[model samples]
Target: MPETPPRARALETDTIRRLPKVLLHDHLDGGVRPGTVLELSHEQGYAALPAEDVDALSAWFAQAADSGSLARYLETFAHTVGVTQTAAALTRVARECVLDLAADGVVYAEVRYAPEQHLEGGLSLDEVVRAVNQGLREGEEEMTALAGPDRGQAAPAGPIRVRAILTAMRHAARSREIAELAVRHREAEVCGFDIAGAEDGFPPTRHLAAFEFLRQENSHFTIHAGEAFGLPSIWEAVQLCGAERLGHGIRIVDDITVDGRPVTDDLASAIARSRTEPEAFALGPLAGYVRDRRIALEMCPSSNVQTGAAPSIEKHAITLLTQLMFRVTLNTDNRLMSATSMSREAQLLVDRAGWTWTDLRRVTVNAMKSAFLPFDERLRIIEDVLKPAYDD
Candidate 1:
């Protein structure tokens, strides 16, 4: 093998961690710190955790979720969601999530959680949203203060802004209610709505009422599609439900081909062939629609690998999607479960997939563009914060 070219070489770990990032698909219940889970479980008197000690519990979550089945990977959320059932627990988890992301150099994030999952503590859905919002606000203030007088331009760590995307479990029946809740709090830190769960049987069409309501009210939403399922799910999400973005849309590769042959199983070969002969690759109608419309694919490499959506970082469809300019954005779907952060995801692509600084910067810009934020705010962050920071 030949030595790697300098331009394509991976950036240093510390340098990657210091670069600013934007995250669009992160889960609140999926990212609770193990220590927080233990403490909260103790405080709430819930003892169903698989492990008692912090380290053991952390390892358990990572291991349990590493199973190469999406259904099995979702089982790890029980302990995390089990512990955070009250306002205080939810608030603490949300605040810590922001701080952790800030430390990992995520300047902007839209953290999501199913509101119905946290209501078992007897709190109403409204209260659940309020508790999480309170925590997000507190975290934002703390990050801002940490940035000090210069507003983080001169500091080692910069300020972070975290917004909420209210999620409704797709298997449940409260999607319309959750959509209404999200629209109600749209001005109070809640940025959007989503439906997430196993996507096999519970199709996006099942929640048609909720999507229709959101669109009628002029609210933004994304659908969890094309991860465990295939193109039909994505077709319904885009054509039927009007999803603003796709949550883990890696399976869209099922609709792509190279030289008239499907590239689902032989993605690495297809990618290599495309590099030498770009004209050999072709996108089917659904893929063309998604790409032409710039529907952002919130691709989480490690999480997708753990759930067997992709083989590995090097062979992940994200690299091919990025090469094809498919409006791809990097994300850490579950920080605790995947043992990953924004920086870690970027570093993996750089090291395993030979992505460069330009690649990282492009994805970051793509995320900001696809963000549910108002146009001016998105432009301000991209022009003022993201561009300046990446330029350095």
Candidate 2:
């Protein structure tokens, strides 16, 4: 594997690998290191793994994810989920994920995990949240110490500052309860709430009570929408449920059209124009609403392809969406399952999507801008952390 250089400025294929990124949709359990899986599974005596060696186990996971079957792709998580039943395992995995993102040039990240899933080993939800928070604090402190006092003139800042988002599985029946749980920990590591699961059969409307509660309490939340599903899911999440962001919102492509054909080409062209003009096309009702409302899209390329949300990398809506200034953000969604890093995700867009240094900086900044933090803190991160680093 090639190494990213220190203090990269321009967005070359290699530069994208070193440029700072902000991720908002990565899953904690889904991003566990394969070696950690092997170690934890061995310790717990989980009977689900086919490979004992770490390298072989990672290879197996990659193969399974590439199999184009969501069920088979999900089976890779059996070991990760099995091992993550205890507080110690959850904390270690969470810490390692932050370290991994930092090494991959992710300057900021929000890792989401369902607390209910980790409580199977006899810990309470609050205990699981605390354990994860402890890991995040450790990772941030370590990374900050290693960052030093800025490398004089060349480099501007450090690697990553991570937060946790508590996710409610869509198939589960604890939406309101999870919503309350997320709100209870806003000042802690819990930054926001999310609902994630199979998007086709389950929609955000199913969690109306949860969304309503969050809305009433002024709590932030993003909904998994329009990934494996279509416009209906996006509609429910944004129009009906009031989602702050749309996770893997690739299916917003359904509402766009080009030359009388229901496709993303002209939309892509329109997006390409917006990079320079910003007033190239008239937005349809759906596009207009999403754009006007500034609903961020947590787009993940590899995960999109793996989950059958996108046919190919080049055809992904990230290109068009960013060009159109849709407040697009690059994300991992699942680092382990996708066999990807934040750097690799940005590198792919630069390689296949024709993104430039300005493009990389702007997209990353877009992500930071849409983060579910207080205005002052978000501004501090952007002006103090992101701007100085990339402006060079």
> Quick one: best TM-score, which candidate?
1
lDDT of each: 0.90, 0.81
Model 1's number of clashes is 0
Score residue 359 of candidate 2 by CA lDDT: 72
Per-candidate clashes, comma-separated: 0, 0
lDDT of 1: 0.90
In candidate 2, what are the lDDT values of residues 293-371, reduced to their tens digit? Answer: 8899999999888867776677778877777678888888888888898878877877777777777787789898899
For each candidate, give its TM-score against the true structure: 0.95, 0.91
User: How do the residues 1-392 of candidate 1 rate in per-residue lDDT, one tens digit apiece?
Assistant: 98554335448887788778999999999999899999998899998998899989889988999999999999899889998899999999999999999888888999999999987889999999999999999988998887867654433358898999999999999999999999999999799999999999999999999999999999999989999999999999999999889999998999999877888758889776655676678899999999999999999999999999999898999988888889999999999999888989998988888887888988999999999999999999999988875664
Q: What local lDDT does model 1 show for residue 323?
A: 82
